[model samples]
Target: MNTAAVVADFRTYPLISALGSVQTLADRVAVEWADGRISPFHHVWLRDNCPCQQCVYSVTREQVFEIVDAPDDLQPTAAHIDAEGCLCLDWHDGHRSRFDPGWLRAHAYDDQSRAERLAGQPQSHLWRSDLQLPVFEYTALMEDPAALLQWLIAVRDIGLTQVRGVPTAPGSLKLIAQRISFIRESNFGVLFNVQSKADADSNAYTAFNLPLHTDLPTRELQPGLQFLHCLVNDAEGGESIFVDGFAIADALRSEDPASFQALCEIPVEFRNKDRHSDYRCLAPIIALDALGRVAEIRMANFLRGAFDTSVEQMPRLYRAYRRFMAMTREPRFRLMQRLNPGELWCFDNRRTLHARNAFDPATGARHFQGCYVDRDELLSRILVLQR
Candidate 1:
């Protein structure tokens, strides 16, 4: 326990348990934790992950050594639990490698260990019409790192949140949105005005009852985070609507598995055309990650192009599409509220379907500014703050 431990990345891995023993096997190292969990680390895996200054650059914290440069049979000569509870390996080529026990446990590849890690990860809190919305103040988020982290976590898990006490000024949203990362610019521009206009390029700019749908599915990658800041809200009828897209997908899967698969398997086109630019993308209505989990839901009815699937599958696709649309309108899932001046919404664009009831321009002036921030930046900021 007299030695020091070094990590490879710009993150901290807390020591979960002490390393009980290290046994050198024929091709790998067997590590036993104090809790009696065993994890096997191959010789190549250990050598390739060396965190020393020679193997990893100190400033960038990136790997400098490549595993391919080592011999094919690069087995360690000896392996033991160091006094510091780290796994120290002595390779046949006189190379030394040490692994932090915490990092090792966090990355253990055993089935049991992997399952434990997966269970410990954050999960979405599926909500419905009665959801007690997560709310934060704009001043606290900009001033306190702890507040910022909490707000971001809510956005990640709940997929919908609101911020009040914001300045009712044009472009005030840019200051708060930048607290996460850069504003994702589209053909519409960095900050798109959400007001009724005579010549509106999109339904979003008109005073119409927009249906519940995700935004900007016409692009190859939909925007991750969306920010809608209200600067003026004198309108009478434009109430906000929100539905948890993931919750609907889950219910659909349970109620009608066949329809769920249809949406996930069929690919459709979404296009956005204006005098300035034309954007098109072909993707499934429901996108699944490698693990087959619902990673994203892309649906923009206004921008959806004519279905071009084979005649045989056309009826099936339409049935699934109609069923999904029906689920979105179900009363059990919708959340309705009217945002006032100095309030803004920050939600996951990929998981939360948002809409607005038609407002009368003759009633009063209504102005709101909206912007987007990619998911990568939001996750990165969370990690840095966690560190």
Candidate 2:
């Protein structure tokens, strides 16, 4: 066959033959054997993108991760090829990982095929109040346990619930948290003996006056639900206030649509710092789930920090934040309650926003033990209950 004909045939039937020994697996992609034979053995495993800590380490300050020290051209070593054709890599910091050949090839092909699904799925209901706070008719929840369950369901749905009959005592809140599985550990445990003084001191662990907000926004993975069982009720001005952020957000969307758009689009910075560590996160103030349903409302002035944005963006963000704060403070948007002991009030941290009025420092002491369970866990339990 002439050169042109041979070349044409090779192009049409491109095949690898055992007759030619394999050299370096060139760039570590798939390898084909004779005539339409493909081997799963090809892989470019340990690319520099692995997230293990050895590949990245903090500098002397321990606050920032440095890929390498200065004065050294410590470029990350290329991934090593193993006998099995897996890509093996040991990062400069001594973290190691192996990439599966087949998985690498599969991932390469998958990039175009798989798009991010979305943040959430379709739900039966979206929780909201006319203003910011859910309107709870005491008659609805106080009358009976079954009615209370309905309110609990609402709280479960919206991420906030109200209780009417909690007796005043430190243990009262604990009892309420116990009625349902009070989520324990991490930023949430049974928080009790928490004094108003803690708030005065600005201590997050044991504080009062938890401003109009959601809890734990600075966490990369935030806890889902917060249950605060109010054990004491004698204090004046210390009414339990609840706000439906979703409701307020929806209203904003309907009213001054520009303001609502600004709130939804801009990123708000939340930060928490103490002597030991500091955490900061930048997230949109109005968070929505898949299907465009309102999910969580996160607006905490105390937790917010200075952000990196243009001067023009700042005014709109500041305006939206102020407007939302104003609506949250509105009495109409608030559902007030004096939770007695035996009432375990749960709120979806992702959806509902909650705040409390300053309690009289002398009206006995206001103590509430609280905990968090993931919203997923709560919903799973609900599903089991439905089943």
Candidate 3:
């Protein structure tokens, strides 16, 4: 095949003016961009990512190229910036590939590019009681994509949101969850009733002053999102409480760095063993992402198992644990509300610690149906709506 003819054809395209100088490296092609940035595309990567109909299925947009069959010593024999501003390459294995420079720049893996990508991720807004929680009406959420998108974005960023005027009936919780994605079934069914029960296996089923905690921390993969629909909340007290675990962690980090580090370094055991199921997991109380940002908080004092750390580390762990618990209960970090009937509360289980004030069940009935959904589904729905 004549390589000159391919370059001449690309030159006729409208985007050719954006093309810059190109050089062939030992095993890749370095294309300089009009913005004074250079992006290096490996020969094998270029070949595997070829946008040609023969390499990629036109209908499915799936790759047809076999990575294993690609030559191990593949390198660009001839490379240049085509008239279409694409990095045109002629490989030693007689294979050709053309990559859009814009695409390459957008996907560059350099340090600056990676940092920018991370910065572009959805940011969380820390809040206290003063911050008015974003609320969406159930009817609007069901009928309008914009309303649903707004609620989903708030839940993703703030880790909490409320929906009012939901139908107060059984299975309504699951119906609303279905609007986001499939319900994440666990030891608790897809939809579990949250009323006081005799001989309750969990503290949540009782009418006691439950301390602030994340649910099901004993599980290795804890649920990311939680939905609590207040079907009937007429009892005295039992006000719902929420604390931004991430915000508290950040506060701890600022106030006492040593305690925060200890919480992040020590792995505490959480176990839930009953006649029906035995679940246990070990994880740090404060979890950080690759960038050292607070990402998750797993704390359940009720379900915490025996402290299995060194004697010397025990005191430090206890100090850190107490510090974290104290911060969670602080009024400056807590948001308390009495969820009325026909209201549904949704929050990020991984980042928000929830609790309930003691209520007298004998006074009136207080029922709430609850369920879980993975965070990916919530974010996925938001992305689809944005598109």
Stretches of model 2 off by over 4 angstroms after superposition: 1-152, 163-184, 188-192, 198-210
Please write out the lDDT profile of model 3 over residues 231-341, one tens digit for every residue: 898799999999999999989999999999999999999998777999999999999999899989999999999888999999999999999999898899989999999
The residue-by-residue lDDT of candidate 1 on 335-361, one tens digit each, is 999999999999999999999999999
Question: Model-by-model lDDT, in order?
Answer: 0.92, 0.56, 0.84
User: What is candidate 2's TM-score against the reference?
Assistant: 0.57
User: Model 2: per-residue lDDT, tens digit, 202-282?
Assistant: 443332556777877777656677867655545666666677777788878887778888877888788877665677888
Alpha carbon lDDT of residue 321, candidate 2? 75
- lDDT at 74, model 2: 28
- Which candidate wins on TM-score? 1
Where does the lowest 10-residue lDDT sum fall in candidate 2? 1-10
Off by over 4 Å in 3: 1-18, 51-68
Q: Which candidate, 1 or 2, has the higher TM-score?
A: 1
Q: What lDDT is reached at residue 291 by model 2?
A: 52
CA lDDT, candidate 3, residue 119: 89
